[model samples]
Target: MSMSTSSMSAMSSAPSAFMTPASATSVLISGAGPTGLTLACLLARQGVAVRVIERAPQPHTGSRGKTLNARSLEVLADLGLAGDLLAEGRTGLPFRRYFDGAFAAESDPSADTPPTPGAPYPASLHLPQDRIEELLRARLAELGVAVEFGTELTGFEQDGERVTARLADGREVTAQYLVACDGGRSTVRKQLGVAFTGTGEPEPAMVVGDLELTGLEPTAWHQWFGPQGALMLCPFGEEGDRWQVQATPETGPDGTALAPSLEGFRRIIARHTGRDDIRVHAAGWLSSWRVNVRMAEQYRVGRVLLAGDAAHVHPTAGGLGMNTGIQDAWNLGWKLGYALSGRARSALLDSYSEERRPIAAWTLETSAAGMAAVREGARTPGVGLEAVRVADITGLSLGYRGSSLAEDLLGGPLRAGDRAPDARCTDAEGRPIRLLETFAGDRFTLLAFGHRPALDPAALDLSAHLRTVTVDTDDPAGLRDTDGHARRAYGIEGDALVLVRPDNHVALTAPRGGEKAVLDYLARL
Candidate 1:
């Protein structure tokens, strides 16, 4: 059940104006990875015309990235797909580090509180990237949007108003916006002559094939850091049977590819696990990838924009690559929807690069730092600092600073440019709910404090259409208890007002007396 065929056909048809053939296409997204599929799904949900192209004939089934942070879960919840994903995926506890086959220190995700008020899925979820993409594809199909697979985006011609993409099959697709989710070796980024500058480390790691283990206990993930190197054995399935074993290679120079032979893989496993009799299943997919921390010089050039590995590619040390790409889609999805719908200014699209590029750079830098610490064998004071640093690779610590969204505050609490945290609260019926539950729908939320006072809703309209929610606070601390991270991140104090965008960023904040301040801010959006 794709989007109505007639509507899609109408969207594909050329416009009557002479601006450009590409501008006639609403939004054309390249690559059907999680980023492209997510952007497609969100835009389609908002009734925006969108199409996704992929070079692969089908979705990737291998277990690439298996960790999903709390912030990513919030984004999934916003799309109403978190429940389904959570049902199918396993939520592992924080990763535990090991040294010399002994327990080192454990990194607890629950330790850090969420930064936004009323955020759902505050805990990191452990799900394979393939599963997440599957869920996203299913969601996209339900919206009547099928990905055009086996189709390659050969080249593109971009003018001031639109982008004309030349497909490998000699077909021309014109789109108002061209998004490149085309992985690390992005043709789009190269065509734009965007330099991906970074250094590749000489650490050779081997991801073992899909193996069903027998002897090792399936209680938790096991990481062995010995004289040889680091070997991490993590559970990939529910019954704790199937596992993904990663070990540093014994013989391989820089740029030399490791042979994916079963003998070679078993030798490393025997060296680390101290078991030569362990049976090996048919190797699913085994290869070595260099660890490089790189980001595109710019995320956008004219009508072309970049996301996922195209914008930035970093070491898998922190499992941040996929999560960052997903977040990139979430940030760009709404902006594209608004702009294409003719409800937002073109300048609003600029914020996408402004806000996300810095975050990507930070992710690249942090991942490199964590890899350096691992190489240097930097151990924390108590447990191993390597594990703590490895845990940070998830990119959950990212936050936004210096943006129009985050500005002056009169100091009641809850400031702009903060990642909204979630808390447990009750509606008028006294039913318990999370703060993110209020923002389940596809609209902006204006969280108002105090009693049912006389206020004009239209004054707070940041867009032509917006959603507002007024929650009277009886216990400020109680609200914080529900979502302390959001309160502190936003600087929400007693009797203060807060405006949260659809994507959960604090758009406006005001003191108790400045209701007009909030009103005027919304009018500007």
Candidate 2:
């Protein structure tokens, strides 16, 4: 599992992994965007050789998707980049909704109830896509991994054992697996001929320039649902006081196929704010994109798999697009690393599509509904007027179901496919630490409780290959109440041990006395 010096050099030299040798390329990820870069960093940390390819010459500076949920923050924390990101990024505090330029409802993320114990990250953070990429790139550089830019995957061929991708420069690189993080127009997805079944709703909105307001009071996020469609103004960061404004375009048929002009953008802003003197700084990024709700027919076609926008594309109403992609990579990265390291069976790869596709479908539907609500509000002023629930807008409620791991858990509260909640606990040294802090690095965790006299730790000797943390709890009442779902999910109650996967899902739960059963489970994996 050692990374070759040549692969390290390739990551530092090229924008894509095309220059890296096949022997050094265990995982070849196309597109070094957030999802691909995050996956590369995760694999590299685990001693897996990962090569990332991107068509863009360098990191994109556009103000694209700009919301990160608690789940995504947890994944970043695992990569050791969450602290830096939180410092650089702004928190979506005092969550508020505006109707016709009037405040409707508001709540603070920090004031919310603490998550059930054992969960990793429990709140959302607001960071622009560019800033997030910057953090991810910094992390990859720290791990001696760099994304190869200006490299495009022209074509690819997958065999029984590996996948070989042909680059635009006529270079061929082979790897054990090929992941497509290339955006909505993914060539890999098209090459596989997987149907992207979805329709686009015409949004005749011309979101104008990155303006720095003088008199406009800036809060968390301002959404205006007037007769003129939805106008959303979101704060980017402290520097320059950049704000992204989205409003309906007076010209064109529902704003379809109409180029966004600065003049057109200014008019929309003036119409909404009733101020024509607002100074425009610079149009950092501007484009009109109609909402497209679509998901790949399949996430995998042999060794070639799809992730991020390549797998699904939905409206930005809920800001779930980027977050969903990152989660996909987080789930797949560890599984691929473990399986490639010969610790798990190839069938483990099937779970990627099984667990992720449905989630993507749900995101698409949810985002579509949100967009429909917004559009309806635009058409019939204040028709569907209701406070935008934080869960709906944040995309935190999305979870996995219908997997073998989940199905085995039955209808218990802590069954498979449920997110493992976080809890506060004291370590051996009596130092207070969070359960997520235990999973900070990329590794698996095992939680053990109850009084079992003959439990043998040596039965799970894979510790050298896997990370194991055993929390021996004598007083069940001392355990975090949020752990009920975790206990039920693992089918463990009193005097039991539960093995958690790297993604924080329960892998196996066994009674504390049944060391043999636990050993058998590890051996099977």
Candidate 3:
């Protein structure tokens, strides 16, 4: 019916020295970007004490990392913040391109694909990275945790028991675990001596910045390609005048490109577009970008772990950078919570690296291929933005099928480690509810199917960490799959049970009487 009140209370009120002035916190997360903020919100929702620190004085102003893929949006929706993002973000915005200052073509990459009942968000959302962080901060604040800005993790040391970190503000914090989401040049990763192996582009590829510009409509993403290079101005931020400027650098006679500056940006814009009417009034957050593909060999060292860009950094071609990092946090949050709660062994955290490291490797490959496609398109006439491949960028097809956590006792269309699909169902009162709504909270979900009988949640010995829902075709008292959407999505025809993880991946599948297999799967974690 509901979370076992006694079990939840016992776990939440578990005695922790973390509340003491000496111990400080349960988890100490460095870098208040999406990765750290998402992990903090998840852990806080489970009543775990978390401390987040950012070296910057305030929130980042630039509209950096603007794309949120469908998978990341689903995770945000589970956290109850997707509504705010969808309300503010623009979706299905067509690409308006020009060649040599003349109109070329307009195309929408996500035009063919539409949202399905199982996958509601099929298109990506275009929103500034800063706004995403602001929403996450608000959610974190509601959970009674505030990100400490200007507080830097200068260094840290960890043993088998705990982590002791020293901040630039001369304060030392002690926590059960430490996580680094501090971007590509992570000090923690460097201190851990993890090898970041990959090649880098020697030359500056592009200059990106946020600016206030006129002569540009805020309706579509505008691109200008000419002899000098390519320039793209996409409307973003909360105001009508704001836009993100990305342009190729102008090479001098000496074979060196000019560095990114406001004057340089204006000159490049004028030369590329062959128009001086597009005024650049003010510029902010300018930086020269180069293609660097690198990944950490391992994600965890002792009690300190790496996440986000700290673990991997790849080309910014398919907008996978931010989404990959956000998903990384989602995978780790629950494992960390289980470990800290003492309900699971500390070894459970090792799966975090085993499962996610391969995904990052795959992302590096996908993004590199996407970058190559963009380059090939640039050389071909009339290719325009259509050259950027739009397949699998949504991240919906990704799964941990090879993971050790995946248990395959019963074979079916959806196997262990597959993403659990959502379906429309109803309660005994005939009220409609989505499958994702039932899986939203940070807990394992057990879906028991068949008309014969159901495994009781209280008998599972995981009532504190699990929720059980019975799906029966004939029983009016259970969840009514009137349209058979749940059964069709899961490919179920008879009595079966599905166990889902906190990250919404199927842990295992079994027959009606196979309760031991379910407990064994969770015990391995």
Candidate 4:
């Protein structure tokens, strides 16, 4: 698990330039995990000054939060990282289960689902979290920003206008806003005195680790459930022998949990699967997991904010933890960009907590329920690790339908506050284009269907923040919906307009003559 050359360079290249008391950035992010890095990437793309700090001395090598669902893929696709990620990750792998020493069942988790034109990424991608962080760090470096490792935030205080934070080294920095992407035990959140209320499992339930093991096939996720308890070894990484291991905790005669070790994991595997040949030669990232479901009561406190695990921590049953954090960063990135650049009023920042906190609440409940169902299913004779799999885990169905940002002026199934669905079309040159590609970048996108809207960008006061694309159904002059996929996906047979946020969520849906509605909605933000 060596760091990539580019990653090491990026780490070395980030000097203490932002460590001075007079130093200033639009956004100061604490923690360089997926959530913090995502926010940094988005802010950097918008030309906002951003600094990401990680307390860790080096990049994490653990295989934590190992799956990115369809929604997160779409979010990364907007950042132009999905192609490289898909090439490196595996998708649609079946789950193989065993009862004691005998094979029980095999099922494709995504058996019935097929990729549609609008939703091209229908499956989750399995890759190590450390590798994902490497990709994000490289992208951040390309944007002239690198994570400052080993820089811990000791304390912070914020006024109405700015936040000043003190580092462990006693250096102070100032920023328009500060974000905490630190894990569940967040210093920032703790200092804010925000209550993180939730329940926890009675005790540590499982031991998790990454190991190079033998006596198992590397094609599919293998699982065994027997009197010795459950053991799951998922094939991962480029190396064939590498696996992500999760096993029921091995306890002492007094029922006390044993610390995870190579020999201990080896014994657990052999006993659970009844396979004497299985051997665990090397192990990394060994740790115990206790189910804890909690979320911050508020996502914001004055000029400071909390995101990712800092705001919430839930059971990992549905593989929702990392994806949820990435989405939180995505949702907040554009709002922060607009607020900092004066494109939108600071009131726009309030919508970040409004829109994202509810999603975290839902995530806590959903993951807890999933954990309960899996525990119950494991007691049955036929069920295996597949019991932990949850349906609609893609998160595509989640939306901000109830948010104030949603303006359903033109009522239909494709309403505002919904994810702007992707569609296929051809440019005037007859080159292929996707709606997502067109929507990619740091500005709002206005998709005008059937014909170009008569509204003037300058008149709407969105000249700096908006990009409008005309979709023509019949003409070869602009974007042509040749196969009618765009029209069908949008449920529009005639002239219409959809205002998409920088985060790829719909803000307003207006008819051909409803230009004022779109303008008024932007005015509110």
Quick one: best lDDT, which candidate? 4
RMSD of each: 6.7, 6.3, 7.1, 6.5
- Residues 338-392, candidate 4, lDDT per residue (tens digit)? 9988888988888999999899988988888887776776666668756764657
- The alpha-carbon root-mean-square deviation between model 1 and the true structure, to one decimal in Å, is 6.7
Task: Tell me model 2's lDDT, rounded to 2 decimals.
Answer: 0.69
TM-score of each model, paired residue for residue: 0.85, 0.85, 0.92, 0.94
Clash count in backbone of candidate 2: 18
lDDT of each: 0.69, 0.69, 0.84, 0.85
lDDT tens digits, residues 95-211, model 1? Answer: 566666566666654456543444445455666677788888888998889888888987776667777787766677888889999999998887777788987656554545555
**Which sections of candidate 1 miss by over 4 Å?**
1-24, 94-122, 201-209, 252-257, 378-397, 453-464, 473-493, 513-516
Ranking by lDDT: 4, 3, 1, 2
**Superior candidate under lDDT, 1 versus 3:** 3
lDDT of 3 by residue, 111-151 (tens): 77667777788568999898899999999999999999998
TM-score winner between 2 and 3, please give it: 3
Pick out the ten consecutive residues of candidate 3 with the lowest summed lDDT: 1-10
After best superposition, candidate 4 residue 388: deviation in angstroms? 4.0
